[model samples]
Target: MTRRVEFQLIEKEITRIDSLVSRGETELSWKSDGVLEYMVELGELVEGLWRRIKSAQMNVGKIKAALDAWTRTPLIARKDRRKDALLSFDERPEKVSRRYGEVERAAEQIHSLLEENKLLFQVGDGMEEPWQRYVAYVDGIVMESLRRAVGCSLGEWMLDVFCYDYC
Candidate 1:
């Protein structure tokens, strides 16, 4: 889950930073280059995150698929939100939470990583993380994509890795 979230952010950041770079014409200033260099670093991380997410996703999918062959997808006993149900019934919410946490941790890491490179920007060096402002935007896109892509749906595939003991 965390891997998925990080993967999504990494992709979006690469696109966003690249676009900013393309539109930028700042006279080789340190912040500009810091942005550029960090963007490059971000791109590398994003690609790495994507590969890992895809692998984890497929692995989870495979695990689910295998379980699906015999395991019945559990349905909610009463009408309730999926997340609520998943938290209450899904035995492996830890996996999702752990996955989600990984992305969160990465954002923290990248924030500092981006700043260290931002020294190249040669401006606003001390207290604030210069790159902090961009984190929310990129993180939002990542979460939104995953929510849009995989969440808000009911399907047989959902039941494999996450078995509903309550249902």
Candidate 2:
């Protein structure tokens, strides 16, 4: 999928996971058979979102590498001129620089999301019970992921919450 489409899918899944967590928080019965099934579905959704996050990270890495390679390569080689001569011959350096900037921005966003939620992703890894694990995972990860997916920085999110409560 295109990068835009992949990002859209990730955002959609984040919303869906958030909705599930909201329902699970207030409505789900911990001891009901239906709750077990709900937890199972949530687990599947989280796993899928994790996979997509990894894939997007990898793609960003690849694009950055390609941009790096392009920047290093000389469009023309002239032995008669100084080393700086090759810099002048570089093709559309501005375009490459803009593309590189875009890639770097994307990489930074993805990196920040992963870094912020690193522990949350592993919340229930060692748990022995599926329902308990899923509950923990949803409570720990979904809200944070939703915040990031919605393009809110931590400070911004906190401000919004503060405003909602006190303003």
Candidate 3:
């Protein structure tokens, strides 16, 4: 999911698709099949989000459990002197998890959008030359938005656990 790797995926797959098109080796049926495969991946992500949404009520407990795990992390070493500074909540329990309520709301918004757009995306992806269709253009835009939201959510979760330095 790193920036460097994303387009490699697009490049590898899209090149094959574009090649088939250029060689006039692809028929309408193949285009439809490719679109279906793409939608299926998108659908799985949406489904995972839906399941997470359904389990939102337990997230606080999960977060707490994960936070507790930090103390037991082997990375913290037996002779580690950095322990106090690392675990100190004295500076305040960081801003990332502090805003969990809003984050949950935002996640819910994405879940709602997925529910509303699920069928639309399927239909849109199935359209003629959908890879070049106008509706497909919008789907790409929405996919970007979804990627942003997903990145934000996971980033915040990582920050909350001090898995990486906070911004």
Better candidate number, 1 or 2, judged by lDDT = 2
Top-down lDDT ranking: 2, 1, 3
Using TM-score, give the best candidate's number: 2
Return whichever of 1 and 2 wins on TM-score.
2
Give the TM-score ranking, best first. 2, 1, 3
**lDDT tens string, model 3, 1-167?**
21222222234344654564554444445456566665565566556544543443244234334333322232212123343233333423443354454446644654454444333333333333532443343345445655655565454445446743653
TM-score of 3: 0.23
TM-score of each: 0.27, 0.41, 0.23
Model 3 accuracy (lDDT, Cα): 0.42
State which candidate, 2 or 3, has the greater TM-score: 2
- Where model 3 places Cα greater than 4 Å from the true spot, the runs are 1-127, 130-132, 163-167
- Kindly give the stretch of ten consecutive residues in candidate 1 with the minimal lDDT sum: 69-78
Off by over 4 Å in 1: 1-90, 125-167
The residue pairs that clash in candidate 2, if any, are: none
Q: Model 2: C-alpha RMSD to truth?
A: 19.1
Whole-model lDDT per candidate = 0.45, 0.51, 0.42
